[model samples]
Target: MIWLRKTRLILLMLRGMLICATVFPWASVAMRERLIRNWSRKLLKLCGVEVEVQGLAPGQPAPRGAMMVANHISWLDIYVIHSWHPARFVAKSEIRSWPLVGWLCEKTGTIFIERGRKRDAHRVLHHITEVMRDGDLVCVFPEGTTTDGTEVLPFHANLMQAPVAGGLPVQPVGLRYLDAATGEPTAAPAYIGDLSLLDSLDMILRSPPIKARLVVGQMLHPMSDNRRQLAGFAREVVADLARADLVAAAASVSRAHQVEAKGADQPATV
Candidate 1:
């Protein structure tokens, strides 16, 4: 794999510094979130990456207090999903240190958890319960880890537990990538092995626009009571999402040049 060239690497570092400076303010969580969302979307576009969303219409109004569970494919998937919807993410704690991404995550009210740490995870869960009770939206990647665009991994039960509290409904979202009808388009998906982050960044910067499909699947209401019930329900959602129309009929999910919010942006829980 080609590492980032020295000049491009310097440019990337400067971009990171700029990202931190712009988004790391004491502004209300809402304003910070919109800034991060707008920036992330811009960055991806700068990389020549175009996004598409199916299963839902653009600017289609959605109810609040909903949980979106989608298949995890790559780090870019978050941008693809978030660009389509203004929703908070449930992320692993490690991601909290990923340079510009981490800073943006903090400012945007991303619910982070210490993986495999029961106590820390519990705190996050409690926070999620509070968010659900408040009637907001949260997007979950139950596949947990990223994967190649081939198959969906078995979702961990813990990730699915967030929607259980307050009896909120879970919405399954299917994320997939395909080649253009003519030629085989390349893609960068999550696979095993600790590949250098810079490598992924450089690779994407040099590639053509990928065709993506973010299918918002049917919404499944939670089966009341805790325990494995929520996990089971999540599993069902994952199953349906895995089977949704991937590339048969492509739909676009591109955001307009700007998304003008109705009010001042302040951070709010999912």
Candidate 2:
């Protein structure tokens, strides 16, 4: 059953990408956003992942020309964010070479940055500033790599320069993935370390459904002239939120176990 679902989702995703490449360019901003959100939501559903969002009030518009920094976990992080808010992402330059996925990312206005090149950072920061000035949201994972979805890695301060230069608000978002059945945090969706993409996908498909929770932290106005300070503040906000999520997940699991224990202790009804 899982294999069949995965196959069907893969085909649908391909079709969606084709439509995005051929039609999205001519679409209005609102139309493109709607399509992306719908596509992402459907993809998550197909992957048996349920999303729960908090902090950002329902129907509250995302801040204009802002930088959204989130912790990196699975490859699903992009789609997860897009499902709620479609923003241009700052990604590694190598993603531009990945097969169809790369093309889809390009069409969706992703900004590619060549890592380890100091000059490239300046170029990318300039581009990001321009995008924000245009009143479009831009997202970045400052950790520069994926994690196990339990804790946030230290954020590199360089990327914070874009928001400072652009004079845009910086928003920190926290993402946590929990096992639906157990109510405990799960690494099933994490694409960390040396795991190949195919292997990660296989693990996710074979696992039980996952609950992805996104918590939006308060917006930090770009008041500091220091990018390092900005990055540190953003990391602090994200870390606090991540800790809260883990605590909540642990409490939820404890409650579930307590309920199960009570049920087990009850005499079986004849």
> Considering every candidate listed, which one attains the maximal lDDT?
2
Considering every candidate listed, which one attains the maximal TM-score? Answer: 2
Clash count for candidate 1 is 10
User: How accurate locally, in lDDT, is each candidate?
Assistant: 0.62, 0.83
Clashes by residue pair, model 2: none
Off by over 4 Å in 1: 1-34, 57-59, 180-186, 226-236, 239-270
Clashing pairs in 1: 29-266, 29-267, 30-265, 30-266, 30-267, 31-265, 31-266, 52-253, 53-253, 65-136
- Model 2 over residues 1-270: C-alpha lDDT tens digits? 877887888797798888887888699999999999998999899888999887766788876689999988999999999998999999998999987788889888899989899999899989999989999999999998999977788899998988877668887788889999887999999998899887988889888999988887777766545677667667767776665554543343344335435544667575
lDDT of 1: 0.62
lDDT of 1 by residue, 1-270 (tens): 123343544565466456556655556656655655675676556655666666665677655777777777777777777676667789988889987668766656688888888899888878887786787678777766776766766767675566665567777777766553533435554433576776676656555566666677556655444425455445544545545553321211101001112111434445
Error of 2 at 171 (Å): 0.7
